[model samples]
Target: MIFGNFVSGLIILFERPVRIGDTVTIGSFSGTVSKIRIRATTITDFDRKEVIIPNKAFVTERLINWSLTDTTTRLVIRLGVAYGSDLEKVRKVLLKAATEHPRVMHEPMPEVFFTAFGASTLDHELRLYVRELRDRSRTVDELNRTIDQLCRENDINIAFNHCGHFTSP
Candidate 1:
């Protein structure tokens, strides 16, 4: 009878709704699932660190699973451009970059927001959904590179706050 119960428990544990290899965020740490044992699970952190967490803790903790049956993830990119830059042009460039990226999702579409007016620059936010979490880094790199190239070609300057600026007259 004890052996039967143990087998049943194992079945229950293995049949959990959360599957192996899901991208999950527990507390503030986010990682990809490496293994799902009967009693615990192993996840590989973004920095390649391994974390072993008990299965029971997952039941009681708040976990954000990015790939639960659906492999879509939302990404937000924030930028601060100089005050003189045209808002419409900035939005167009950011949206164009996000949509043109290979990893970005097209069904949900990309959006750009004029977030805030700061002392020196205008804060903008770009949001897009990606279907693959593994390609996040590459997508971000491409997006930033595109943004920089577009800004340079259009003569739009990204903003940075410094202590002082010396002008030669």
Candidate 2:
């Protein structure tokens, strides 16, 4: 097993699947690569915990290196509006919110999709992209706040689950 791991490490070094500082998701673990050794590689997850993964796993398992080709990442925001809300207005509000955000990449052109009609609401999805992974969290937060404000101003009611139970007396 040690020999196999050593060989796997050598493969990883040569193939360059992941490197120090690369943000990656390997199976259930997602983090930045902190160190790479012949026998193992260390990753620092978002919570600041260091996780050591066997070199063999790198060679054997699937990995997603978010920073590999480009740092540009896409974000999807899903929202629903109460039934009877104007669909056209909702689309416009979503587009305005996304396009006005400074961190959003304009070249890709944000899009809004009327995904489905839920039991009690109309579902919509806003898809947009950001230039860097570092901007993801802040961008999402600001966009959500902006969207909420915009929806309220437009008199659109964001939908929520409504449950009613009737018991026979």
Candidate 3:
């Protein structure tokens, strides 16, 4: 009877429709939930490593579940543009790239802000809400690539660290 009751409790906990195969972040570690057993749940890391954590850990730890029905997620990209670059042009390009990206959310739209002014450059920040946090790395890579391409096409120079480059006129 005790064993049956335990099994029943397990079923109730693990049977949560939104609980399994969800992308979740606990602290700095983020992964997709793989399995839920009677005593523990398994998560597969980005590198495909499995982590077995007790069920109690979920209750005790702070967790960010990206798959909890609401798929909206916020993404930020920081960029440093050359000091002389047109701020409005930079803002326009950033917003355009973000909006055009396949994974970026359109309803919420994208925002560009002048975050700060540095010695060699002007720092700008772009914020957008995405539908899935699981695609964070890929989205970021694509965004950066698109930004780079746009910058080149628009003749907007990106700020780089101090490094001497040989020039022959």
Candidate 4:
């Protein structure tokens, strides 16, 4: 076991599925790698909690490195709109919001997808790349706020589930 861990550690460090300060997902935990020790790698997640993963597990299990080859990471935001809402306008608004964001990468540009017509709303996904992998969460939040404000101002309804019967007083 000791020998295996040592060997696995070297492989991870050298082959570099992920390195320290990289954003990665391993064994269901997605976070930034804070430390890489001989036996294990430690990560700090969004909540600031440390997750220690064994080097052997890293070698054995599937590891996803988001910033491995590209610091530009795609961020996805799925929003549902009222069935009657205009998709053309939605596309424009979504693209505008993404383009206006400071961290959004302009080279790829933002794309809007009309994914599905759900039970209550028309599902749409906005795909945009961010300049920094670490900026994913913040960028998403800002985009959400901007989308919401724009939706409200433009009188676009973001649909939600009102599945059950309800009475308005």
Candidate 5:
């Protein structure tokens, strides 16, 4: 097993599917590659825990190297509004929230999609790209705040699912 793992490690080093500092998701683990050894690799997850995985797993299992070629990543935000809201205005507000954000990419351009007719609302999706993975959280935070403010100002009610059950004799 050691001999096989060493060979697998060599393959991983050369193929470079993931490098030190690269963010990846392998199986149920998502984290940054901290070290690559002859028999195993170490990943530090977002929670700051370190996980050691056998080198052969990289060759056999599917891997997602989020920072392999480029650091750009897409973020999707789903929004639902009251049925009577103005669709055009909602689109404008979502676009405004994305475009005005500093970290959002202008090259790909943000998109607003009216996705579905929900039981209680109109569903919309905001698709935007960020230049770096690090910007995802902050971008979403700012955009959500902006979108909520804009929706309120425009008199758009952000919808929520309501469930009720009653049993009577």
Candidate 6:
């Protein structure tokens, strides 16, 4: 069965299930593929550590390729605002933030979903696409900063954990 690894390596080359420089999550690891050998595949993880995964694992385990089809990748930013905040304003603020960011793609036209009502807040999700996978982090940070600023400027408060308090009467 050891030859299975070699065969799997060949399959990868021919099938092109994954490619070098692609960001993928294989089993417990997620990173950019640095090298693909006959018996092992290497990835440089977010922590900057090189991970060597057996070629058979790719054949057996479920895998994800964030940049497989194209360099464009969808990312979601989830946020919660204190209840009673104006929903319309919230949507506009998030939309503007996405549109203003240069790295954010315009075609998908970033969408904001007024998802749920929380115990202490209103939960919403911002879905956007980026041109480069590597820009994801910086784009997120920019979006977050913008959201924080917008929330502050608009007097919208970002909510925290809320729990029912049982008081002894």
Task: Give the whole-model CA lDDT for all candidates, comma-separated.
Answer: 0.82, 0.95, 0.83, 0.90, 0.94, 0.93
Give the clashing pairs for model 3: none
Q: Weakest 10 consecutive residues, lDDT, candidate 6?
A: 156-165
Q: Which residue segments of model 2 deviate by more than 4 Å? A: 167-169
The true-versus-predicted C-alpha distance at residue 2 of model 3, in Å, is: 17
Error of 3 at 73 (Å): 1.6
Q: How many Å off is the CA of 148 in candidate 1?
A: 0.6
Writing each residue's lDDT as its tens digit, candidate 3 over 1-169 gives 4455445437638656327779888766678888877666778888999987666556556877888788778889999999899999999999999989999988888999999998888999999988876677789999999999999999999998898899999
lDDT of 1 at 141: 84
Clashing pairs in 2: none
Error (Å) of candidate 5 at residue 24 is: 0.7
User: lDDT by residue for model 1 over 1-169, one digit each (tens)?
Assistant: 4444445336536666456778898777789888777666788998999997666556656878888877777888889999889999999999889988878998799999999999888999999988877777788888999999998888889999969879999
Models ranked on TM-score: 2, 5, 6, 4, 1, 3
Runs of candidate 3 with Cα error greater than 4 angstroms are 1-18, 163-169
RMSD of each: 4.9, 1.1, 5.3, 2.7, 1.6, 2.0
**lDDT leaderboard ranking:** 2, 5, 6, 4, 3, 1
Considering TM-score, which of the candidate structures 1 and 2 is the better prediction for this target?
2
lDDT of 4 by residue, 20-51 (tens): 88888988999899999899899999799999
Q: How many clashes in candidate 6?
A: 0
Error at 32, model 3, angstroms = 1.1
Show where candidate 4 strays beyond 4 Å. 163-169
Give the Å error, residue 52, model 1.
1.0
Candidate 5 per-residue C-alpha lDDT over 1-169 given as tens digits, one digit per residue, 9 for 90 to 100 = 8887899899998988989999998989999999999899999999999999899888888999999999999999999999999999999999999999989999899999999999998999999999999888888999999999999999999999888998998
Give the per-residue lDDT of model 6 (tens digit) for 104-138.
Answer: 99998999999998787799999999999899999
Per-model TM values vs. the true structure: 0.83, 0.96, 0.80, 0.88, 0.93, 0.91
